[model samples]
Target chain A: MKKIESIVLAADLAGTAVFALEGAIVAMRHGLDLLGVMVLSFVVALGGGVIRDLLIGATPPNAVRDWRYPVLAFVTGLLTFVFHDTARALPFMPIMTLDAAGLALFAVAGAQKALDYRIGPFIATLMGTVTGVGGGVVRDILLARVPMVLAADIYASAAFVGAVVLVAGRRFGLSPMLAALLGGGACFALRILAVMHGWQLPKATPW
Target chain B: MKKIESIVLAADLAGTAVFALEGAIVAMRHGLDLLGVMVLSFVVALGGGVIRDLLIGATPPNAVRDWRYPVLAFVTGLLTFVFHDTARALPFMPIMTLDAAGLALFAVAGAQKALDYRIGPFIATLMGTVTGVGGGVVRDILLARVPMVLAADIYASAAFVGAVVLVAGRRFGLSPMLAALLGGGACFALRILAVMHGWQLPKATPW
Candidate 1:
């Protein structure tokens, strides 16, 4: 139990860092103030988990209950605000890989949490995907872009697959850590491959 | 107890109808399919309550549990989808009045529910306002418009006031029915008056 708890916290914090950087950079690009940058950073980092928790009836969402999350998010935001050019200059491949890893961890951990709440497997899978993609969706909407997950990318689809695998592993008696690793690995791999191959959903052909 | 439940349900359904109509029209303007219209309609109508319930740890939210709510929302959407022009031709004043009443009921009922969950008063007021405007905000985001609540409008402000009144009345031992009437009346009056007088939040001056 301790191992599982630590693993989840680690995943959450790591994911928070990745998204916070992206959110802060976007805020700077939009010409928002420091406060706006911090707020968007926090929202991008933890909005998904909060939404997932609410759906599963986990009140006082972790983002609010734990000081570490907001602190890390704001600190990351402040740093990004101060060095926006550097953050923007981050190499695309590395950030993309980190983003994929974050997505995988969030999916696996979120599915596990949903199962702990005794939700049905199907909905739990959805919860996992939501945990992975919800924050980014909100950020995109705030920026007035079509949510990336709703766009051509296979991002949420990868999360969905990871969630399914995690749920299935648990149903088949796999240990939590093992299941998480397998699920997360699958998601990470799929996202990377999708990016490398430029895989995307088929667009509706112009009539 | 039964009285309270029915009253809340009435408010929920009534608000759902008003929001569903608004969502349907927006979807139509975007040229969404029938399915898209229905889905957006459901989201707009029930999203606020769903978000409120999640924050208060109400699992499997009432919107999901009560068939009546979704059924009514979808039916309204379907009718709007078919008779869109007629719905669009609705007199402005009547629709605006109905929208205000719906906002009032949602604010009062949502705050009461938050109080029932024993959330702090300040947060409970926020929950009530979220219940009044969260769905519309989401709808706007999907439509790529700045959320009206975050824009220059007295809408969410009125909801906040209504929620505060409701919570305060309950704290002072007001009867549930009386508290509901007092809070709802205040919200309705404020929103209508603000609309009539073109009240808005101050805008920033351009340099």
Candidate 2:
């Protein structure tokens, strides 16, 4: 693969693996079959991107057009099924790290996509944030739970910060790769730290 | 309410009622609480139409702009909660009949909305079908079940038939309201008969 292609592939792999694990957790909770687990994983990985693309009038959204994404998700899901016991035994710490990485990549990719479409910066930032949390929201809704991002965390806020940074970096003549790395690193580091330390936004007080 | 408003309200009420009952069925199976039941009902009633409208570039999808749709769903959910045992004991036959009516009205409304947007007839027909089945698909996905429309049923197909007929009628100088009713009626009757007699499209031969 070319350089950008390779980067995109890496991003997809990270996203697929993390989302598959999350889906597996839900499946285990629901006592669903292996097939159901795989289905939910695939849906959680692709659902947000598809909805985003469709809303922006991108026909045959990236999830449908890109064979690699689905293939990666499916393979990841299969592996999760095979290693269900081992996976379950592992602590949540490492998986949470992977999830943060995936979120960083997705936020960057989503902002990049909006920029390519010539959408306004504000809209691009919103899209990036949505892309970052879309899958988790879909997963939660499907599981009949509130979305994790909305729960006292700075997940989407971090995405917004990174996207704005990326935009500003580009405006200041930084190369795309350098800017993306800066933004992505910021998001990943911040999210990881937040998760590790149980950091969260203050809850709203009732009047 | 004005005459048209009254008609729209009646249709909305019927559709929401049918959709809420469908949601309640799933909620009962999952043993979710009253709040869960209402949330699922709202999703099932509006999810598909909202998706279709957004894809077609309609601003403020009907479900969002009109408060009545959700209000109807909420009321139906509340009623279902109050009469849980009675609602559960009702035979599937009446519920299926009401579902058929809701399907017909939604199909007509979707086609009309597409035409209002100046989309072509074929695409409008597709939109109609999507609007008719979209909510149910979202609900099923959230419930971790495969959408019922993907099964060997004529549900969406019937919507397509109705849309095409309505378009043809309009082309032949029929009144919009009259054409809509005929087309919608055809869809309602077809669905009712299909469910009653186990009608289905021919399966694709395993090549």
Candidate 3:
């Protein structure tokens, strides 16, 4: 149990760091001030988990109640702000790879948490997808852009698939750790392929 | 107790209806499809309460668990969609008045709910302001517009003041009903004055 908890914590923190970097980069591109960059990074790193926890009746969400998460987010934000130009110059492929990793980790984490809270399978799946995409949706909204989840990409779809896999695997008696690995791996692979192929959801037929 | 509950329910439903109308109008202006219109109306009507409920450890969110809220939102959306031209042509003052009423009711209701949940006065006040503005923030985000709360107006300020008044009044031994009435009335009056006078918060100094 201790080992599993440790692994989950490590994965969740790593995901937070990567998403914070992604949010900071977008904030910089939009020419937001230092404070704005920090806000965006914090929101992108923790917003999804907060939403998921709140829905599951976790009052004073871990993002708010636990000191470690915000510390990690703010530190990541500061580093990104200080190294904005260097981060911006990094190759797009590496950034996408990191983003995919974050997405997978969040999706699995969200689904597992929902299950732990005894939420129904359907709601758990939806919660997982929200955990994967909620932060990015918030980041985009702050920047006055339509949420990418609703507008384009195969992003939320990947998260949904991963969540379903995790929940189904658990029902079939797989260990939590094994289910997480399988779900995260599937999400990561799917996101990478979608990016490479320029895949997107079909839009509403032009109003 | 039942009387208070009934009053809260009526006010909440009224607020939902008005915000749904506001959201539908914005969707029509943006030329979104029917699906988009319904989505926006639903979000705008229920987003605030969802946020409030989640923060206070209310699971599943009343917005999702309760049938009446969504029904009211969808009905309002459909009406707006069908009478798009007529709604669009209506004078701005009446719409603004209706919006102010919703904002006031949400502010008081949120603060009251937070108090019921035994939250701190300061946090309750903040929650009230969130409940007042949260739906509109979601609506603006869906339209790719900067949230009006952050960008301009005395909108959140009015809600904050009203919430503070309610919390303080209760602390001083006022009944919940009386506090709500005073708080909501203050918010409504302040919002109307701000609208009429074009009052706004000063923009942050550049960078």
Candidate 4:
């Protein structure tokens, strides 16, 4: 149980860091100064989870409770600023890979939490997707740009797959850890492969 | 009671429009094109409340619940783009005044909701201020600029005052609407005056 909890925590931190890095990069792209970068990092790391917690009546929320989220965000922001040129020079593929891992974990955790609250699977799956993409959506909107996930990408779709897997695993009586691992792994692998192959969901059209 | 509810709803819509306008202006200042302007407007109008709701356990949130918010935002955004030059030429003072009203209303409403959920006074007040400034903070950050309220401005302070007044009024057995009105008025008046006189709280020493 302790080991499993630690894995969850580690995944949460990893998610926070990747989201923070994404915010910092967007800030840089927009020519914001260091303060702007740090603030965006904080938003990207904690914004969605904060929202999720609030909706679920989680008081003070994780961001305010676990000082680690803010600290990690701040550190990520500072590091990005310090190594602006070098960080930016790294190819986008590696960054996307890291992001995929974070996305998978968040999807699994979000759905799991919703299930713990006894919410129906449909809402749970939706919440999972929201939790996974909330920070990035907020980050992109703040930067006044189109959110990357909403564009032609498998980002949201990959998260949905993970959420469905988790729900299905539970019905099949899989252990929690095993289910989470399978769900998370599927999400991560799907996202990475989708990015590599330029896969995208077709945009829905009313016309 | 029904009449009063209508009034509150109207106030919300008006606030949405005013905030949307403020967003468009900021986008113009940043030299954003049409799509950027629309996106900024959406963020500035709904970002704060969305964050506040998420924190307080409001599901699907106002952004999703009240389709009017986004629709109003889009309309004002298009209007701003179509009449960019005229909108730019308008005096800043009136807009600032309207924004002050919106801030006051949102702050009081946010705090009241938090208090209704049985959150403590300090946290309630924090939520009030968050609801008031969240959108603009997101807006400015996206524009690669410092948040207006945090910048030697009396913005959040005014919201804090409003929140406290509401709490105090409730403690004294005042009606909810009455307390909210008093608090909201205090916030609006103070913010307007602060903007006029360039008032601001002392910034804490930069660690």
Candidate 5:
């Protein structure tokens, strides 16, 4: 149990770091002030978990109560603000890869937590997708742009499918670790492949 | 206590109806489909409460658990959809008044709930502002626009000041009803006057 706890913590920290960097990059691109950059970084890194916890009735969400997340996110944000030029020069492929990893981890974790809360399976799956993409949606809204989840890539859909797989695996009596691996792997692969293939949800033409 | 509960319920229902209408009007102007209009109506009507509840750790926020809100919002939306032309022809003054009323009620309710949860006055004030403007933020985001709270009139500031009044009153041992009345009246007056006088928050110019 202790091992599992440690692994979960490690994965969460890793996701937070990756998402914080991504948020910082976006903040820099948007020409936001120092405060704005830091705020956006924190929001993008931990907003999803806070939202998920709120939906599941967890008071004082872990992100708000736990010091580590805010500390790590803010530190990464400060570092990025200081070295924005270098951060700006980051290649697209690596950033996208990290984003996919973060998305997968969040999706699996959200589903796991929801199941523990004994929420119905359907809502739990939706919660997983929300946990995966909710931060980016918020970032886009704050920046005054269409959320990518509703517009550009098949991001939330991928998370949904992954969450479904995790829930299904759990129901089938698979080990939690095994189910998480399968779910995360599926989400990560779909997101990466979608980007590589220029995959997108079809939109109807303007009337 | 029963009287207070009924008043709260009445205010909530009124706010729901008004915001739902507002959301539908925006959706029609944007040429959203029927489904889009209904979804936006539901979201705009209850999203603020949901966010406030989440922030204060009230899970399955009242808006989600109560069937009345969704039903009211959707029915209002449907009516708007069926009479979009008439809805669009609505005079701006009346709509703005309704909006202000809803905002005032929501702001007071948000602060009250936060206080009930034992949140600090400072945060409770912010929560009030959030509850007043969060739905509109979500609505504007769905339409891919900058949130009015950050860009337009002194909307959120008005809510914050009103919340401060409410929290201060409570701290001074004032009755809840009196505090709510003072807070709501202040918020309503500010929002209306801001609209009437074209009051706006100052923005820093680009370098």
Candidate 6:
């Protein structure tokens, strides 16, 4: 049990860090000042989990009660604030890979949390997809951009698939760790593939 | 006690209806189809309360658990979808008045709920402001506009003022009904005045 907890914690923290970085990058792209960058990073890093926890009646969300996550997010934001230009100059593939990783971890974590709260599997899967995509949605909204999930490549779809996989694995008696690995791997791979192939949801015809 | 409850309920329902109409109008302006219109109306009507409920550990957010809110929102959306052209042609004053009323009701309702949960006055005030402005924020973001609260006029300020008034009234032993009335009236008046005068928040100097 301790080992599983540790693994989950590690994954959650890693995902938070990566999402914060992505948020910081977006803030820089928009030429937001220091405060805006940090705010964006913090929201992107923890917004999804907070939303999930709130929906599940987990008050004082882990993101809020657990100091470590905010500390990590703020630190990452500060670093990004200081080195945004350098980070932007780095190859794009690494950033994309990090984002994919964050998506997978958040999806698995959200589903697992919902299951722990004894929510129905369907709601759990939806929660997981929300957890994976909610932060990015908030970030994009704050930046005055249409959420990429609604318009871009198969982002929410990957999260939905991963969440369903996790829920199915749990129903079939797979260990939590194994389920997470399978689900996260699926999300990551699907997102990467979608990016590679330029896959996209059908756009509504302009009136 | 029942009277207060009824009053709150009435105000909440009215706010929901107005927000749904506003959301539908925005959707039509953007040329969204039926599904998009319905989605926006739902989000704009219920999003603020849902956020408040989640933050305060109110499970199954009243917006989602209670069938009435969704029904009302969807009905408004349908009506708007069918008569969008006519609605758009109507003079803007009635719409603005409805919006001001919503801002007032939502602000008071949010603060009252927070107080019911025994939250600190400061947090309650913040929650009230969030509840008042949140749905509109979501609407603007979905429409790919910068949130009016962050970029535009004295929108959030009016909410904040009303929230503070409620909190102070409560602190001074005012009845909940009276406080709500006072707060809501203040918000409605201030918002109307702001609109009439074209009041705006000072913009940050462009970098």
lDDT of each: 0.84, 0.75, 0.85, 0.82, 0.85, 0.85
Tell me how far candidate 1 lies from the true structure as C-alpha RMSD in angstroms. Answer: 6.7
Every model's DockQ, to 2 decimals? Answer: 0.14, 0.06, 0.18, 0.10, 0.17, 0.18
Candidate 2 structure quality by residue, lDDT tens digits, B109-133? 8887777777666667667877888
Per model, state how many residue pairs clash: 0, 1, 0, 5, 0, 0
Clashing pairs in model 5, backbone N/Cα/C closer than 3 A: none
Better lDDT candidate (3, 4): 3
What lDDT tens digits, residue by residue, belong to model 2 across residues A114-140? Answer: 778887877887777777788778766
On the 0 to 100 scale, the lDDT of residue A15 in model 1 is 87
Which residue pairs overlap in candidate 4's backbone?
A54-B54, A54-B55, A54-B57, A55-B57, A142-B142
Alpha-carbon runs more than 4 Å astray in model 1: A1-8, A202-207, B1-42, B52-60, B63-137, B146-207
Clashing pairs in 1: none
Q: Report the candidate with higher TM-score, 3 versus 4.
A: 3
**Chain B TM-score by candidate, in order shown:** 0.94, 0.91, 0.95, 0.94, 0.96, 0.95
| lDDT (10s digit) by residue, model 6, range B94-196 | 8889888899889988999999999999999999998988888878778797786897888889999999999999999999889988998999899999999
Give the better candidate number (4 or 6) by TM-score.
6
At residue B203, candidate 1 shows an lDDT of: 79
Model 4 lDDT at residue B101: 94
For residues A76-108, could you state the per-residue lDDT of candidate 5 as single tens digits? 999999998899888999888988999999999
Candidate 6 stretches with Cα past 4 Å from truth are B1-42, B52-57, B63-137, B144-207
- Candidate 4: misplaced stretches above 4 Å? A33-35, A54-61, A203-207, B1-132, B135-207
What TM-score does chain A reach in every model?
0.94, 0.91, 0.96, 0.92, 0.96, 0.95
Q: List each model's interface RMSD.
A: 6.0, 10.9, 4.8, 8.0, 5.1, 4.7
